[model samples]
Target: MLLSGELGPGDRLPTERELSTRFWMSRNCVREAVRTLSSMGVLESRVGAGTYVTDLQPQVLLDGSSFVLELLRHRNVWEVMETRRVLDALAASKAAGRITAEQLSELRELMATMDSALDLDERIAADLAFHRLIADAGGNQVLAAVLRTVAGGTTAARKRRGLTDAHAMERMHAEHLLIYRALERGDADLAATAAAAHVAGVEAWLLDTDDSPADQ
Candidate 1:
């Protein structure tokens, strides 16, 4: 019904008994189906009311993606990184044109956090925030939600790469400066190039060291 447009956001689903009778299925089966849809964010069950179709927002639908990606990342590390690079580039390009003064300030703060972070863990957290802020500033909630998942899934592997190289964080911070400068200048092409280049460095290193458990 949702795909066929017979049902939409805020539309209440038929009762399980009605659905079972209409579809010639057992009531238990109908109940199970509703439960599954609810878990996927396609349906909502109110306390005093019955099931209804949800708003179907992309962020809501993709909320569990981080967990799924974490489970599958080991087998598809390259694919995940590739997707992240493309998304990050898109986010940076869009943000270059749309970023607000407040967002720019926040990015500057995050950069400062990275610069003064006392340890690898603190630096990593700041690094993640910097990318996330750009994605949010892009004005595309769906893109930001997806990057949240893909970037989060690869965090450990990326951190491992950071751990192995003594100078990795310094080089990464420099790349980040280039990206931030492009965004500051409102240069979409430059922002995209810089974002892709930053991710590409990690991608190349990941591919070269994939056999290592640390890399995986």
Candidate 2:
């Protein structure tokens, strides 16, 4: 009922007695279900108030999966890149056809920010924003959340373990411009290709060094 939109976020759940009576189940069964939902972050219990649905935002729902993402990145970076290549390409392709003018503007701004970034951290920040905007423009919250999870999971760890410099930032800036231009032209195929190439470059760098994901 909750997922079907019968009950939305912030809606209070029925009392345990009401639920038990409505469902023809015993109070113990209802209690068990409530406990399970709470554990999943789908429901919350107030100190004195009744239970309510959680906010249901992707971040809230995906927070518990961060450790899983960390485990995947630590165990295999190729797997991470493999997953990203598909998702990033799909996001770029969708954004090529669906992106709004405002989204395109934002991406261009991020490109400029990446180009002018004096330090590695600033460049990375802009780079993250660029891809996130593309994901948002793709119009898929679930995919965006998953992408964020993996990106966040590996970004710092990879930087710490792999070698990076100003030259890398410059290269990323140039590559990002190609992606933005593809989207600007509404060329879905071109966008996907550009996105794949950009991701492949990063993978090459990560695999080029002696350090690996597990080392971090």
Query: lDDT of all the models against the reference?
Result: 0.88, 0.83
Best by TM-score: 1
Kindly give the stretch of ten consecutive residues in candidate 2 with the minimal lDDT sum. 157-166
User: Once superposed on the true structure, which residue ranges of model 2 sit more than 4 Å away at CA?
Assistant: 1-6, 20-36, 46-48, 161-166
Tens digits of lDDT, candidate 1, 149-189: 88998888768877886778788889999999999999999
Give the per-residue lDDT digits (tens) of candidate 2, residues 1-216.
686798899999999999999989999999999998887789999999999999888867887888887787778878877788888998899889999999999998888887787676776777788899999898888888888777776576436532454367667767898999999999999999999998888777777667755665
Clashing pairs in 1: none
Residue 174 CA error for candidate 2 (Å)? Answer: 1.4
In candidate 2, clashing pairs total: 0
For model 2, what is the error of residue 64's alpha carbon versus the real structure, in angstroms, after optimal superposition?
A: 1.8
**What's the TM-score of each model vs. the native?**
0.88, 0.84
Estimate the Cα RMSD of every predicted model relative to the unseen true structure: 2.3, 2.7
Which candidate leads the pack in lDDT? 1
